[model samples]
Target chain A: MTTATQVEKEFILNMGPQHPSTHGVLRVILKLDGERVVKAIPEIGYLHTGIEKTMEDKLYYKAIPCTDRMDYLAPMSNNLGFSLTVEKLMDIEVPEKVKWARVILAELTRLNSHLFWLGTHALDLGAMSMLLYALRERESIVDIYEACGGQRMMTSYIRIGGLAKDLPADFDKKVRHVLKLLPEKIKEYETLLNSNQIFINRTRGVAVISAEDAINLSLSGPMLRGCGIRHDLRKANPYSGYENFDFEIPIGKNGDAYDRYLLRVEEMKQSLSIIQQGIDGMPEGPYRAHVPGVVLPPKEDVLYKMEAMIFHFKIITEGFKSPFGAVYQAIESPKGEIGFYISSDGTNKPNRVRVRPPSFLNLQSLSKLVEGSLVSDVVCAIGSIDIVLGEVDR
Target chain B: MEHNLNEIEEKILDFLEDKFSGSIISRDKFRGDWSFFIKPNDITLFCKGFLNNYELDIKYLSDMTSVDWFDHEEEKKGRFEVVYNFYSLKNKIRFFLKARLPAENPEIDSITNYFASADWMEREIFDLMGIKFKGHPDLRKILTPDDLEGHPLRRDYPLTWEQPVFTWNKDDPPEVIK
Candidate 1:
């Protein structure tokens, strides 16, 4: 008979600025005693590009594309938050059609982000096939984006004052197709993992956090909702015509990885309904708001008319001068509440542009959530939070 | 809606004036948002009141960031401003608190005791802006590497300045590749 040696000391393990399961360049310093994690200190900033500092040097309109790079998965939502801040500072109300169209695009972007999250979250938990199915559904949304914005992933479509252009002629057809196909596919995802023993064992009762702690840590969106807190910014403080839409905020009971997964899946369903409402009730008016010297003129008008050409030239060259004040505008991003705080100094260039990235703040709770849990559960905890390092290190 | 805002504003202003009378330097209302400049030392006190007050239980801390005013055109209180974005989840309202720190050594008390989320926010501020957060448990560089010298977000830090090669690992000599 062999006698077991007693191991009393905790060893430190560095889990990657290069590991595959981390989803990006994120390094977690895990202090462990055998198989249990005593403390998990997440060391980020490997992917820091200083996008916020870069945005301050660029013109106001030039900064929109930079926002796209922050939350690469939810580019349109980031654009919306930045543009809403600029509009709020300039006091420009978008046309009704622009509002409705923005709503559709934003919800579609939310769907896009959630689909990617679901696929990666499932794959990390050893369900390999879920990724393929999730990516297939996500491709359709990308097609819609390419059709509208002329770019696939980094589509800076939603510009200040209005969209880059009008919605494509086939926008309605493509959106309705996605709206019809997603419900059944979402059910397929649920059927595959909802009852699977392995999935439940990996996620349920693992990396649990309470509602009060979640709030204290400033976790938002699905992270907060997973803790059974019914606080959705879209419902509580509606912006960009979100008040007009009818949807439900999903909450979970356990605040574990499983509950967060279910909440994200249900959120995808809610997003489909919102897209349906957007397409059905889109108002009829000018796609871009008429703000000369501020909003860019239509391409057709720029080609045909001299005044429109002059306005375009002015906006492109010098850029629009904004009033001297700061405004914080937040929107319900797929990850959480992504807000932009802009402080203008009566110049074309912004004096300060601070992005309140949800990923950065949400990732702060990683240490709190992963402490005292098993080492294997660390991946589950990170996946449940759904952090994009691009946004986290921005 | 506007009338209701006026009523809430009156009630909260009355309550704040009654409670924190001396700490509030000035207040401004713009674009339906209220901002108050509080004394740097009394921020934690105001935040405690904001959390425990029945009507103004602003428990959720949305964000905390710092702004550098090196070449700013506007007249300001100090060379640096730390902005706190607080929200009341129950009442669904947003407010701002700003504290000004002098140029010599910009320092403020960390709100980690009142709001746990301020840990990383203060660390980031300390890292990028070089504003010392007194009493923070882990006050170290966050978004930047450990070897970085100057605060990158300050106006004095040049945008095009480059870090010298192998400076971070200076102790380990580099071998020549023939």
Candidate 2:
């Protein structure tokens, strides 16, 4: 019998299921060759909650709340995507005010999502101050969320018919106040991150993916846009009256982390433009459409009026039946083209509900980008992709 | 009679009269959608022919997924169906190709040879729906785990194995809700 060799040739590196910096239960099994990742085998499902099957059992209306769990960073966008699919299947028309409200809130949510991305992403790279500063700016949007929906993080505010309820009387003022302060705060962030030498050296050419490769990998949102793909679902395929709004699509030439960073900085400015237009050209109408039977009557209306009370009772108990059909609705979420495919069987419960989450696709490109790069470069690659595991694992 | 969407459907139907039948597909100017039910073996040929030979140029494979129709109530021969959504990004035309495959033996030709984007997508289908990608190079799990047994997206799969917390009015079980 031969004695076992004293020296070990290979060592296994176990990444997080509970580590804070892994962002979310993303356990990556890295085969190491002396600080170099030879083969990266990602082990997922620690955060697997089986969201898809639950949607199959939940009714079309009941499924909206579940969406809040998908991309917890941008719950509003997921809510919008799911709601849009239900609306398409039901073939219910939304009011102008509702569209504007969706755009504004969705944009605010985009800002919220990006702030979290920038914070956590910068935090991963040891930019401790950026995380604090970014979170400080993001708190305004969280406050706005709390004031409107009585929840800060997962606000199931955007309902299928139009909204959970009409925008509170203080909605307009709170939104405008935040909008006014955002431009200055954004400039402050740009000044800090745009010219920082350490940040520049770390991100400039790291994790470069060309436009063609980005498309082939099916990357979307900022990752795709960062690769000079002048495509945004809001622009390419308009939903929620995005056509009426005027905004520019900022493209990147280098298709690197720096380019992505630059593009997002510009995007924040463009988002500001879109929000201003939405508020300026804000239409006045019934927040929800005239689909009385489909939309739940207001609490006050239900409590006061007998007709409203009866409709509310029926809607709450039996649930409004949607048209029997399948429809796929996609929206330009902060991440990318978040698509919702819903199948209705002429019943209260949905036959099927599927979310084509962007982070999942964006994360798919990780292997391609990480295949040859250094292990340290992996952090930048992860940051550049800006994936939320909530959406990815969902 | 001109080249309306219905006319196109009728034209395709007339061309492939040997394969399809019924009013399930018609040109009613209805939903304004084009759907093609293709044979599992014919998907590659159809996609290539639809793009190159037929000048359909369906260059963009927008999404490809497999669905478990276990709770479908149809009791049909097949328990699952694979859906491929194609888009001609140039012409702005969209076509949906669907194929039914038995859940017991879910195997189909991988479309990665035609559209490179289908590589990860097919792997995802295999990972989530347990559809065996016959010709895929890497047919392992993309989003889940290596040792994970059941595909979680299937209708039969439970949402979560964790038990619920007992409320004030509800009866409390002895076991911990883990």
Candidate 3:
């Protein structure tokens, strides 16, 4: 007869590639010693579409649509990041109105992404009705996106030089309506999740990473902020007139699953305030910058004037030539820093278009986050990271 | 609390010149971010020094990626440039370090020892661009199948559509109609 200690051994357990709690098609191979995870190795690439390779073959103006697919949840934020990088490469200044409008749209995108994350994360923890309630609020935001740019999800409204078109007539009214309603809805969500004993037990003190470890791991946005390190790129490296907006960066203390949840809730409220400020201080000017042979001519002008027609034809056919230089532009997307390292070769097509996806980088910390936690906490830890595998495997 | 951007850039440049004088190949500033081009062999030492230094405590590795410079004649000193973007939370500054590697055998020293975040990023560069990292603990394909043939991001790789697996000729399709 053998003793129980003599027979004990560790075995490997594959958690995903199709698991519901992974937020996308992500596989985590966890090594377990009777329900305690000894090692967690993330396996990706199930959703890879080779978007970066495809971007290198397309023209500069045509690549904007590709960025939207990288982070499908925060399409507008992806658009803004890619557009801002191209604009920097071209060294053209967009109109004041365009900057304000971009800020407002991107903030709305942050709120939309956080709501989806909250709902899906809650559902992963067995709260079924939260998905329906969260989706109800998300519908209003999607309606706003639809009102501005014809598509709700993949609205590549933010173009390279400026916005694709002027804001709709009722854009302001629709946005204000949604902004007014989101706060109370957020409050209801907080009442449901916060202080609930079951929710607390599942989240708090689970997957705790120190501020030092968070920084060393290069975790950003909420993951770094959850560790009580205030490192938001919007405030640190302000771009697209983020400097003009007055808002607070929310920080969390515990760096656990619960702190991350609270931090995103606070971020949604701050995004609301930014939207209100952007609309209140909205500037009036031309929607797009007037860069000949680069920015597209207005449709009416292209129809009427010969010079406008010629410019449009040239831009559509040959695309604009950027100076032979490289620029790295990062924007604080809903997830974290979505950066575009664009190396233009004095041609219409980019030499190299590398996306520093936050999900891909943030997902690196999952092993550290769930090293010694329970198997159940593995689900919570993955949910707290809020990774969109579309972005991760892009 | 707002430090002068130019002064910070100058300070970093001076420190690099003072320590490792001849290693820097070229330096440029684009969009207010300082970029330095260095030899591929010196990246490990430079990254270690940058992380250990007190004034330039660039502990955060923002991004690590590789760019293929295939066609440009004048700009092609090397076929690949592995770029690393680092950020200093204490000083609120961002910097770029690019290491030039030859196209035929692209390899560079890994910085995973300094920043734990570099593990996945290095793996990604290896998988997509075929650039190997010397000391990466686990270097495998991250976003591609294990048996994927060629590096997709290379300029020479064909961007054509995948071939259809099955096709039906006229003779093969006629039997199903009865």
Candidate 4:
């Protein structure tokens, strides 16, 4: 054999467009010298569905359902962003009840997304039982989605003008049940992972980035906050009545995977507080806005009244026209800042609909995260980012 | 209450007018948000100006995308418009910068040198919208296969167009789905 100094040590390794740890179809090309990664180039687009192009062809309100399919984990957050952008473009002020109800739904979605992330991330790090525990808690949230939107994952319940329909009869009871149960389960998860030796070894100081680099890379959500940057859009720029609620934005000291894990766990508690505030301070008003010929009328009214029936026929046949302008609206989605930029040409269909996906931005920092770490740390870093490939390749 | 411009708006207008007055094509406020249309040549400098300025520290590049304004009714600058959305974390304000490029060879200087986040966003605009980003180091297609024919997001590209599949058995007829 040749001497160690004269040998060719560097080699190429392809880590997946199909691996389960990637969370979706994300392929990373790694240049390795022994076990240390010299350079990691991420190759995406295996899940490309051309969603932005498809959205341009559909009517304004009809495109709401398409948003659900992108970030399938937190569909309500996507729906909220798209609807807020279109509502701003059209200059429609939804009722007070709608805002409070939306806050409730959006916060619930944050809990749902974070739970799934915690489960899958822990499982990736060899904590096998966390997956079962986390998913068991997730089922209750899925039940709420089905009770409200009739679909578990693709719940396009939050419509343009307002919600798809009023809250279900037992919506209050079901939400209250989740609210009471999750706080204890969250504490239990902390007890399991906080003291575990394997998790701390893999996560702490694994992928560290400073606050300045995090901002320079344009990271958001927990990614930015984990770097000790206090940048939550809900507090920085409030929307959908998020200003009225009171909650803490948990931040991390070090920009490593372990800090991110702790920050997200604290965020679950904060989400619960926001949900509690929403349920306590909910106001009474119309479920949907009263913009005739634009917003869909109530089913009972459409069946009985002539004007409601005529308006329904018009809205179904040809969607209402929007003003000629553009608007950019962003929300503090569970992943990060998911925004929608819509340009209308005074037509029923939007001129351009561009989604500023949070996962796409967060995924860009992978090369930096796994710069000189071992190949196994790549899995830890990717799981930490919590990327949904559907949104990344959209 | 809505008639008066906010403090941040006044300050941004004053700064832009003071620093780079001649480059601005038009500035408008729609639904309480401000957007500026500037010349393509001045985009890199304008981004530099925003980043270097102490008061208007608009460091974060939220998004960069293009709109194909084909057969539009409203008055616009050119055939293709590249929009950049920037947010100032310090000032807590948003600034929208836009530049127009011709349809034949739409091109603009990439701001990746100024902001590292501009790398992937610029590549995406190149890959999907077919607008070239000059000086982007690795401008390969991000979301599409390498052998694809044309940009899918262009308005001229048919929505339902499908790519022909390659097969080993060239003698067999290609299967078609209506």
Candidate 5:
């Protein structure tokens, strides 16, 4: 007969409700097996602002600004996704010029997001010098965003029927300057990490998820493509005139943290190609659609013309109604396919709006990857996953 | 990419045949999005068959959420309606499964075993809606603190949070945020 052994010596550790490493108000309950993670449970919601429920009451047009703060890094992507869904339901079309400009700006937004990811991902892996170099270039992208839309981060420039306004005259010059400089900067990052034995050893085989497992986990964007799934939403189901642009989807043969990093670097190159194409073959037409009720008139026209003033006032105070239907529009954001699932019941306010954010989905596989791995490698795996807790917790 | 939604509905009904008696499910297809209602008890079985037997292969559980039934309070329509969003990697289609549960006691089977992604998602729904998930390996408040009292996202719950909004433009006037 064998007596039962008591395991009362174990202790639970509270990692964070506010630790810098936990990444954005994320709390993790860590049950330790002497310095090893026995069970890692992520606790969130310290930043739950109830934005989804808040969207239920606000008018559809008012909700555009709300989506920006959800994933602050990829605000334009969120704006584009939401606007595309609204346009799909309304069945309204913007001018060819507006469409192309949207594509260009959205791609630029992708650059901003990817640069931040690169800097932060490397910084998390203890490459602090790389972060400063990456952010130096990232500041220029933010300057472009501000110059084009008059605001940084929360642009809210991508409207339902069209853009908030036309692209600035200097937009092309600025984009071209960044385009010329970005390749060299990217190569600098690659040279620092690509051949470095330490970085390669920490990331090359760490958090290696197979292609089938990545698909099962519903990981999208570079994470899925890094695993060789070749599932780029932009290439597969293009929206916002992405089908018209020409660009290659870079896929990694190895499914690891290093592959994900390489895939993102290659994707930035592809994004530059698409933007250049969009600008070169850009069509000439009006910037905004002809839907007066749905979209706001230009500021000049609103101030000068009586008709434009009334239209703008009505839209600002009492939003327009959308047709009774819903559409799920997913765009290939830098992190992954950022999808907007919108439902309207023929009201000024939306009946339902659910964001299928890819970061949230990609973060699902953390346990699957980190379970058996060394505790020290958890940060590298998380950085490789490239999750934005703002979007994830949202 | 396109199929007769009515025919699909008929097929589903015929497939599930009177096993769930008087389960007159109302399915509404808006645009291309498909949504069907199911009883709380039958949701687990229906979802199982919907994924496996029907070749939907919606192995990816995208998201799970819930809404309070306060608008339908007069109809005594219980309390909450849990919504599930699934994307079938095989067919490239998405489906919305809604289960209406009693407000008095909202309970449903755990789909985590079927879709591992549902592990955290179900916890989120439970944290926000207070809907209990039976057989969930470790169901707890996901997006909220463990010591938190109520589900703060309910209709009755106020959105007037205590956090202050930071503004870079000092000239900007303060707006009353409801």
Candidate 6:
């Protein structure tokens, strides 16, 4: 009955499915009233490839590549999670050397992922130079991936029983080269943003989530740690011989966007230290376990030995069978806790393969973080969560 | 921690037996992680109990997913199973709870009240597996388009490729590539 000017109007704003800041093809629907968001609903699955359904059709060993595409940034961690789950079900144990190498590769993967997040998040917040500098450091890590796995990005190096192959002869030297350079590179990144007024002003007190709310929302990795919860699966659960390596779980007190930034920076340093320790304490043994039917034989053995050739042929034609059971294995991927739940019906192919992708869980907290903040801060809030749409849509 | 994990599992089993009584169908352990199957009717009650239990304090809902068992022989009771993965941050232990739902009307009480994280997960299940979550505030398709016809994750849903509506060349009439 009143005039139109007297009534307050709220409108729905669609943020993305194509916008650069939303990370991938993530579309966020926002109910706004004059620059203030009333409700934010994230519409996902634009990149959905039905990887879970596809995995069920693939053999246990063949499914590793599909995991790589989920969290494309941290492919090795995905590989480690899938492999460990399968290894647990098969009751196969890799040697100590395999464990050490796997840890190194996984940490490198973490560093690679964090670097990408830092660059992209900075770019989202208008810090253009940070992207170039971050990518410069990431190049060396990509080289390491390429050297070992023959692919830069989707290196499914970590296999079911062990590694795809033993570490290259110069793997130590190449890793040491990157490790030596990372500290200085990280320092440069910190110097760029740590005390910068614009960076601090834009990030501090923005997208704040409390410790209780974080746990209730099932946030993980730096998202939970930024809320002052010192929980890292690498430390708490200790899969892939993480117990052997000594590294502190970085925690943040402010539980804001800036705090998440600080936590990821600290995690990069810790990952470097873990990589250093792994190289120093390298164990000497076979790279893969001695599960003949399940794990592929060495290339040399396959070429000469008849038994090895037969085993290889058998495995290539018909993949190894797992018992009828279900197992969940979680690893501390750079994004968060990447868990795999596999149910096998004593067949070459899995009955069901469910990935508990960290990005999917972490992205849920975005609404809570951005609800009360200015609509302009939405990009910062989303970038701080560091969600890879590959993982989210999977 | 090792001793505490065992104690936690035992306490959880005891609590379920004492509280739910006849609801629990079976229990099993996989790679040191405990999993329990509960009757569909008591899922919400059991989840509430577990989440609110003083000692257990299963505060985090890590994942909420469903599995279609249309092709499996062992799943005699139902055609679909809803799986809930819970983690206790205080105790640093994880346990999985599963409930069976018939294929006809796969619906369960939503746990969004207990864990806000369950909102999106429940929606994802609904979108992909065609499982409905009762009491969900905004139940809608999450990943898939709203107009998508059938749940893709169901066993009965064929994985065959869909034919494109447009053809690469107009002169050749149309080659509906599937």
The most accurate candidate by DockQ is 4
Pick out the ten consecutive residues of candidate 2 chain B with the lowest summed lDDT: B169-178
Model 2 Cα lDDT, one tens digit per residue, A1-394: 1233324444556666676766887765666566766666555555656677788777667777789898899989998898887777777889899999999999999888888888887788778888898898888888888877789988989887788877878887877887888889888888888888988888988888887677666677788888877778887668899999999999898888889888887888888788889988889987766677777776778889998988878877778887655567778888887887665656788766767778777776766666556777777877888878888778
For model 4 the local lDDT of residue A174 reads 93
What is every candidate's alpha-carbon RMSD to the true fold? 3.9, 6.8, 6.3, 4.6, 6.9, 4.9
The 10-residue segment of model 5 chain B with minimum total lDDT is: B169-178
Point out where model 5 deviates above 4 Å: A1-14, A324-326, B1-24, B50-56, B72-79, B161-178
Q: Residue by residue across B1-178, what tens digits does model 4's lDDT show?
A: 2223377778988998888898998898887788998999899888889878887778899888888888884435578889999888876778788888987888899889998998888888898889998888788777877667798888888899989735312232112100
TM-score of chain B of 6: 0.85
lDDT of 4 by residue, A1-394 (tens): 5676456687677788789899988888888889998888887888888999899999888898899999999999999999999889888899999999999999999999999999999999999999999999999999999999999999999998999998898898999999999999999999999989999999999988888888889999999999898889998888999889889999999999999999999999999999999988889988899889888997778999999999999998899998888899999999999999998888899988999999999999999999899999999999999899999988
Question: Which order, best to worst by DockQ?
Answer: 4, 1, 6, 3, 5, 2
Off by over 4 Å in 6: A1-8, B163-178
Q: Is candidate 3 or candidate 5 better by TM-score?
A: 3
- State candidate 4's DockQ: 0.43
> Candidates 3 and 5: which is better by DockQ?
3
CA shift of B151, model 5, Å:
2.5
Q: Put down candidate 1 lDDT per residue, A1-394, tens digits, no spaces.
A: 1233344456677787798788899888888888888878888888888888899999888899999998899999999999899999888999999988988999999999999999999999999999999999999999999999999899999999999988999999999999889999999999999998999999999889999898899999999999999999898878889989999999999899999999998998898899899899988998788999999998889999999999999999999888877789888899999999887778898878899989998999998888888988999988989999999999
Position A331, candidate 2: lDDT: 86
lDDT of 4 at A370: 94
State in Å the error of residue A169, model 1.
1.3
- Candidate 4 segments whose C-alpha is farther than 4 A from its true place: A3-5, B1-5, B74-76, B165-178
Instruction: Tell me the tens digit of each residue's lDDT in model 3 across A309-394.
Output: 99999999988888888888988998988899998788889988999999988899988999988899999999999899889999
TM-score of each: 0.96, 0.87, 0.95, 0.96, 0.87, 0.95
Q: Tell me the tens digit of each residue's lDDT in model 2 across B1-49.
A: 2255455455444543433333123222214555555667777766565
